[model samples]
Target chain A: MRFRFTGIFDLFNQKNEYYLINKKLDTIIQINESMYKVLSNAKQGTELNCNEINLNTMNILIYNRVLEAIN
Target chain B: MKRDLNKPIVIHWCMNNCNKQGQIPKGVIEGKIRQAEPIKIRFINPRSQEDWRIIESFANESSDIKEIQVEYDFLEYDIKHCIDIDIEKKLIYLVAFSGTSYLDHDARNRLCNMIKKQDNFKIIVYISHKNIAESVCFIQSVYNEVKQGEFIIKPEKNIKNELTDISVLHEAISQIAELYKLFPDIKLSVYDEEKIVRDIIRLPYYMYGNMYITGDGNISMYSFMPAYNYGLSDPQVTLEEAWRKLYHEHATCDLEKILEYPRYWFKYFNRKEIK
Candidate 1:
């Protein structure tokens, strides 16, 4: 339903440039050059799955733990 | 589809005044069939004490759920009912640290440190503060730093009395301590009343989490938090994708990394890292 592009914007650890394509809504929000790097560098790729902790924590789980690396 | 074009089966953490959140909080039952049918209702935040009761009354109002879930994470008041696990999607809506208090950064650091200790977990964290990690990520990806505060949360109505006493704080800290005891293998550290962060030390690697609680009611870390994490939807709630989504973006998202873009973390926060 939603599509996005992610990659490093620079070598130093500043700026971001990611493009989000919401196909369902026909909208593309280009992230700032600084932020794109922060999100992408946050973690590496993996598979996402659902396990039950409570009742409300089940919607979208990514398969990667890469969200951590980012500050 | 599931409903009219104008309506989607939205899972809302309805607050007391559209900011407090939650209307009910039982495992599952029955309740009023309104715009969102077959959807569970839980009280998230409240303008007054009465707001929570109204939501609790509806917890069993719906006969659809088998159990109720509640989480009071905020320091001020029981913020609201947390998100239930959406099993099919492998996603979870997590409670976020959103206020502009010093506690905001503290909670974020705690969450980041706590969750990162594990190898497998997922959380679609809800954000309350702009400087908080999740909100920061969302802002960097979608909005300008100047506009990040747009989504900041406040008491829908200024009623005050949201702060907690030391006794209540003790109860919360102990509950988490017990949770750590239950899940021995999961990553966590028990808090010692006398020891502060700098004075803290780890258990011997060999003796780490080797103990367990017997059938008796003996309180033990070995039998607590890890099990708590294991039993709760926590195992299923934390998403591997959610973590990677941020990391992958961070890897190549820097302006310099992406087409020679230039940006700084401090530039956005506009605060020096008091070294």
Candidate 2:
């Protein structure tokens, strides 16, 4: 299934590491550079797939609500 | 009582109000402080084009401004020239607003980096609603990032919706207590000893004789209390004259009585009856 990032998540870079913070949930998690690139490249409302990133990472992102399945 | 006119004064640049309202009373900016000595001015939430125009005018017209305090969220442009000019003449105090949804993590990191390079900086965080845990986390993150500089936690004032719950106060106190345990170096701005003393003395805790300049170049005695606006700036009336007139007109028994009761005048002062 294709997925997109949720509005509650905000991306930030610190010490060359990317972090996704869920403001409403007050949860923060660090992500790898490749994951950062994939998330950053995915446009709003655009469906994201394993073609842009690995399935395992995409699954984790979807589970965290950082990405929502579109299809 | 005779007041020293030459003494340094603090002024608030109420940019948020000015940007929203378009203009402020001119009398608020023209005051005894301007005539006496170089003043310290803090610009709050200054982001709009009108706010920048006002800042430019102040930079051009006034040589008496000794310090400029600005928050990081509002700065979108290159203010290197402004900083250079101030460094040559006065001081610039960069401030960061912590523990709010106003700034994202990237912005916070950028702010922390900027603050680390500057000697004069402060991080002012607010505790409100049910965001004590979030605030604590934000403050801890900031503390870990920036080792130097002043940190203060201010209790947010509930004005419009009248959601002034005693529980919010309790939460803020508890949050501060928790913060102290986490970061003992953190400071409390609202409940400080100096503020308590000011409350006991029946005097306005802060911004007593201060002036506030709006975006449209208007002035008021108090920033938040816009009911006391003097009027627009006029070449006919000097700032000193405006100050004298506004103070003379408003510094009455009614104002004194309001000042006497902390519950009525001070927003930070929390009492059981206030809620």
Candidate 3:
């Protein structure tokens, strides 16, 4: 596998769900790297070491991508 | 007659103790050489372990096991330089207990050195030992995580329960796959239930993700973050209890198809940059 230095999911779709989104809607999503540059380096309710995805978006992540996947 | 010359050779670094107890299940060693057409297996067992001797005694010459060698802790040596790494068919399966896979500064350094010397070879290393992930890592309770259908962790202990959970998880992963398919890095590990005693007297405790998911029925998904030099939290996955049911009275796959559900994008910060 290629070494992903800064991106976790890199905006990719997974075959499985990380967890359920409808139920997991409350959870936060994490982003860093160029993707973070786009996301502004944030994950959920709080401003993590990175940034917060203060707003919702359209996407999918199996496991780590669970909540991030849901639109 | 011993082995198809066509197959490349794969070595099993049994070390004396580990391989001594285990023998290559006959047909596998032979048929795999033919069908998989990869390589013949070279069994390396330490001559000292009498327990392993008993297992090897069971094998006959017809088994087609190549040469048997003694002595070599895989961890200590730079295997790549010695082995014919050029042989694309070569695969190494290492099985040693705390003696080899232990997490110490010295041992870790040795292992890192060996791995660093590694080239294009497909190396598979197995840490043979008791399940100590519970004590060594931080395990936390995670509520119903159905999104990624399957959680990643080193599978250890409580098999009877893990199997049941896995079957369900598999189905969920399948569903998720249908929606958004494709992921790299898939791993599967098998354990020996050969010595485990099953009780027919009474049914073991089993629950479907309930508040009290009987101890026997849960699997810990340990998160090993590459970014973090240390380990990440390992969360428990007890399906029913963790997840609240999504009661969407109606279905909408057609809508999902039209929308072409977007993939989740997770950005990562350089480990050094993150404070």
Instruction: Identify the candidate with maximal TM-score.
Output: 2
In angstroms, how far off is B252's CA in candidate 3?
A: 43
lDDT for each residue of candidate 2 in B1-275, tens digit (9 for 90 to 100): 11222222445665565244565443344343345443455666666665555555555564645455564442354445334454423334545443555566776666677567766566666556656677778767776778666666654553321214556666666766776786666543443322332343342212234455555655554443333445445545555555556556653433454455544334334223334
Q: Name the candidate, 2 or 3, with the larger lDDT value.
A: 2
In candidate 1 the C-alpha lDDT for residue B12 amounts to 26
Model 1, B134-232: lDDT tens digits are: 333432322221211112222111111111234543444454344335444332222221121112112111111111111211111221111111121
By summed lDDT, the worst window of 10 consecutive residues in model 2 chain A runs over A21-30
Q: What are the runs in model 2 whose C-alpha is more than 4 Å off? A: A1-71, B1-8, B16-38, B49-64, B71-91, B94-98, B102-105, B158-163, B191-208, B215-219, B224-226, B252-254, B259-275
- Worst 10-residue stretch by lDDT in candidate 2 chain B? B1-10
The C-alpha local distance difference test score for the whole of candidate 3 amounts to 0.25
Q: DockQ values for all predictions?
A: 0.02, 0.01, 0.02
Report the lDDT tens digits of candidate 1 across residue range A1-71. Answer: 22122221111111222332221111122444443343343323322222211113112112111121222
Using lDDT as the measure, which candidate wins? 2
Q: What would the TM-score be for candidate 3 when compared with the true structure?
A: 0.23
State every prediction's TM-score relative to the real structure. Answer: 0.24, 0.58, 0.23
Looking at chain B only, the TM-scores across the models are 0.27, 0.69, 0.26
